[model samples]
Target: MGRIKKKGEAGNAKNFITRTKAVKKLQISLPDFRKLCIWKGIFPREPRSRKRVSKSATSSTTFYYTKDIQYLLHEPLLRKFREQKVLEKKISRALGRGDVTDASRLERNAAQPEKTGKPRYTLDHVIRERYPTFVDALRDLDDCLSMLFLFANLPSTTTVPAKMIARCERLCFEFQHYIIVSRSLRKSFLSIKGIYYQANIQGEDVLWLVPYKFNQRVVGDIDFRIMGTFVEFYMTLLGFVNFRLYSSVGLRYPPKFDKAKDDEAAELGAFKLEGNNALAASSQAPAQVTGGADAETGPDPQTQAQVNKLIRQMREADVEGDEAEVEAGEEETAVDAIDKFEPVAPGGDVLPQPSYSGEETESLFANFTFYLSRETPRQPLEFILRAFGCKRIGWDAVLGGGAYTTDERDPSITHQIVDRPVIQAASQKEDGGDEGETSQQLASNQRMPGRIYVQPQWIWDSINDGELKRPDLYAPGAQLPPHLSPFVQNTQGAYDPTMPLEQQQPEGEGLEDSDEELGEGEEADDSLAVKRIEGAAEGMDLARSDDEEGGDGDNGSFGGFSDDDNAAGEDDADESEDEALAAELQYQRELEAELTGKPVKRDTASPQSKAKVEARKRLAKQAKEEAEELERAKGMLSKKKRKLFEQMQYSNNKKSAEDQKLRAKRRKLEKQKTRAKA
Candidate 1:
């Protein structure tokens, strides 16, 4: 047969109309036109120019596919909209007759139809229409995936319903499961807005975001309807992509979700294959019954046997390593190399191995369980982590309480995870035995989990620490996923095991010189107390005082530390200034009370007292001069400083003049002393 022309290639020259002209032909608003096109899988045509459609010899307009427009006229939504418009006119006519009930009834009937359209919108159709093939869809998945995943984590409202959110969540989770099972997860990051994850699916790298756990607020400012429309399109796109992914790995599409395991918060759980032993037993048998059986029986038997053989081979191909079990009879294969398969051409076509070795699986995971306190919130990090095989996880009540399978103290836990301000659990006496507690308590508790905690960095740390040394349990070969956090510094910094410092530039590195150039900043900051003990004690005391005072009396001895702590060590020197001001204020008030001859109030001071004494002396001597002009004082030695103040004032008149004056005075005093010493 002759080669068939591509779908739109052989169409007549006048078959298509400009998108603009199509909107005019529909006699509808542009937005409505666009919506119809999108709903009908119509795309903006490559503009062939204004001359393409000319009503007048000199005028032209853009065009769209005439066939696409004709197809759109039959859309059920269009008919609904038109029906609604007609009813709206009827309602207006009834209202004009002063028949309110009739108008209202008509309005209600017009708004909804007895039966809605079919759910013909499938992801495969959308993919075929837009991308033509699976790889093409995968290549353009970045933005669509990222946006959909973001919306999936957002709180559902009227515009973005719980149902749509749930659908997006499930689709995203299914995709993540594919990554986990296939060991395709790559890098992940904990960003301010959300956790960013990248996975390599059949050589195509897909990156997406999962928002910080429970940080989503359904704000009124955001137009959820618009976002929901986008979400609707994405949900369908992801569904097809997931189907393709699962089929590629020989797994069933729409992997069986354990509804019992899926919690109210929608945390994903392990999904087991269907049918079990009975199906397996039947799958292995041949179809031939006996010689008396029909001729069809023999081929059936042969097909069954062949299928069983193929199934076994496929299972073998998917297996990675035997790291979890070892025996004297078995040889040690480098677990890391298990996933790396030699390139092979099967049936005249080349495809990467369906899965990697056991070591690769372990390395791909090598993750730890994060235990949050009652104070924290579980972020939407599970998807990103699981996508990369950061399995075997658990967390405290802080993040999606009760979502984890077990508490952090479970013996199976290889690494214990905690974030900043970790509330160390008081050592509990083991009533039974001392088993996995040591490893869980020490190392993992030190690192701070950023406000948005992503588990990928934890996975990377676990692998690097040789926590993944047990190949069967953790690190596995070429499939080992990398740390995803951009915040994770890879520098071989100075090693200080005792200190919980971040990865930094190594000693004798150029960073030291750059820091030295910052001068005395290198001198250890003495403003803060040497240890956290001082602040912890203060906090405890404050909490106790608040309790004792019964929330009424001022607990002067241990006021709430929140105000001071919020300022941190930055307010150290300012504390002295605060005290001095308090004393001056007390003196001034006392003086006012004394002058009025009212029984000297507790808060007042006399003019002769400490408050006004200094002020009076300073003013008497400087009365002739304006309080040292701010710019003049700051200038000290350089006219440039004065000019800077003048120029800044010109640009920004709202800046505080009093602040400028204070800063200038301080600068002048420093210069005067330096000049005297010289």
Candidate 2:
């Protein structure tokens, strides 16, 4: 048998250290320890058995790996924290002794490390340690972008300083500038909670959300201090990312920012990109040739002589023999191949690839210009359209700046995305009298010629389908189809809107099986036939009464029992009386059939039964005429009235859709309950 193990000396006990013990080993306060742990990506650990890690009986012990705690001891920042602790003690002692000036001097010296010749603390090394490669940084960019964007839109409070907010906003703007120049922005969506943006950066897709302007409500439950810490880390990360991106494009990192322009809301325009000197020179060479300035600088005499000699050699070789010509041809082909594979730029450095090549693809809106209305979300629409290769995207002036063309009435604008209901201004009279009032009166239904107007959903649908859908389906007043989630995958036998739910369900699993069980032990067909016979007898009595009132003797009269006799069953009737009664019923039936120009036999295939088909045709025709008249009446309404009518229709349709969603949710919950019960 092995020797008995001591307390806290077996299994994970030796591998883990408690938080309090780690903090003591680092000689730092708990808060400082936590900060170090967060920055270094160290998290608390839970041993398989708490008793093994902690000698105490308490179950709520937080543990960290012994190796991780040992690693923290080597962190340079730990030395700074010790020095801070020492300074704090000195300051407190000096104040206790009433030497205020000494305490002040001590605090001031500690704060200014540069004056004291001590190194200033920075997180640059920590950033490198956390993210070893660029792809690692990108993988973590989603959370970083979300935190920064949220802080940028937040209002400053005592806990959240204004300076931090400004820094976040500046970093976010710089990142946006990179996106604009790179054209890596892919898609965006306007949700009730916030706006979502997805971008493809270096082949990695990153998605983040941004709250609408002035929409964030700061609640007390959230800890701003922790968020501020995260923001600080992300700010440094993004700055480095922006630097790398700008450098890749041959543009100087941290592009010159115009403070005055930024203050005036010149978002992307405020950055002035300066190309690298080498790139600038290379780009200028082509400009010089295109500008015809190279003509003034004639070729050197030696270069011209060399070119002439090369041509003469080539001609002489061609005339000499097939051997010389073959040699020259081989050399020429080799040179051409080398040139074809050579890098386009000097020093074998290739130009950065553009995020979008709009010219090469078959763009859906290649020939159209779009104008977004003020109420619609512009950023997302602009980004998606441009991604699919739409060049000119404009928005109403009310939507602010940064548009290709803000003028809504521009002749070149071929499409407009509007979300609000149409309102036609009253037409103006030739005379000036009461022109305002007349113009206020809505005009008749009309539309602008040569231009198409659609809702904002058209853009999303077109992009998802990879083709342009018919505009009429998404027109302002048109009944739109349900907007299904593009992320949801369709499976066989799944519920579909076009097919009834019952039809999609398997026969063995349907409610019909349960109904059949409940209907067992009953003659369903015979009961149904008896009910139909009773209803037909009542119809015959009504027909007889009508015929009697008309005094038509040609029509047969039924010799059935009176109401009193019918109520009482004829139990005492003799055989002769029953036969006589049955014969009288038969005679009445024949006479009635003869009067109506039909045989006594009930043959539905006879010519007289065709009247039922003619009656159905007449009813269908009347309904068609009524529907046509209603449509014509709608067309006659004024524009304002029509718009109001359309708004009502839209609201009703939206409400119905919401109701359907709620019902579906309830049904899902009910199914879950049933499954649980089973």
Q: Evaluated with lDDT, which candidate comes out highest?
A: 2
lDDT of each: 0.52, 0.66
Backbone clash tally (model 1): 31
Write the residue-wise lDDT of candidate 2 on 394-489 in tens digits: 776555555677765677889988776665665544544553321122123334568798988888767555567899988876666555544455
Q: Model 1: C-alpha RMSD to truth?
A: 21.2
Tens digits of lDDT, candidate 1, 1-678: 999765444444466676666777676667667656664567755544433333332334445668788877765566555665678789999999999999988866653311332342333444466777788878878877887778777776656666667777778777766665566766655567766666677788777766665667666787665565566677777788887766555555666666655654445553433222223234211121111223224457888999999999888865743444545224445544445455465433333465444455434544454443333334444544454455555664334423454454455544433334434654554556565632233333333333223233444444334243333233111222333354344322223232322232222222212212221321222112111223333344422333433534232123556535634532453344345544554575579778997754352323223333344333533542333345335657467766787788665533444434444454455556666788
Tell me model 2's lDDT, rounded to 2 decimals.
0.66
**Model 1, which residues run further than 4 Å from truth?**
1-21, 39-128, 217-225, 247-266, 270-363, 366-381, 384-391, 397-405, 421-456, 460-678
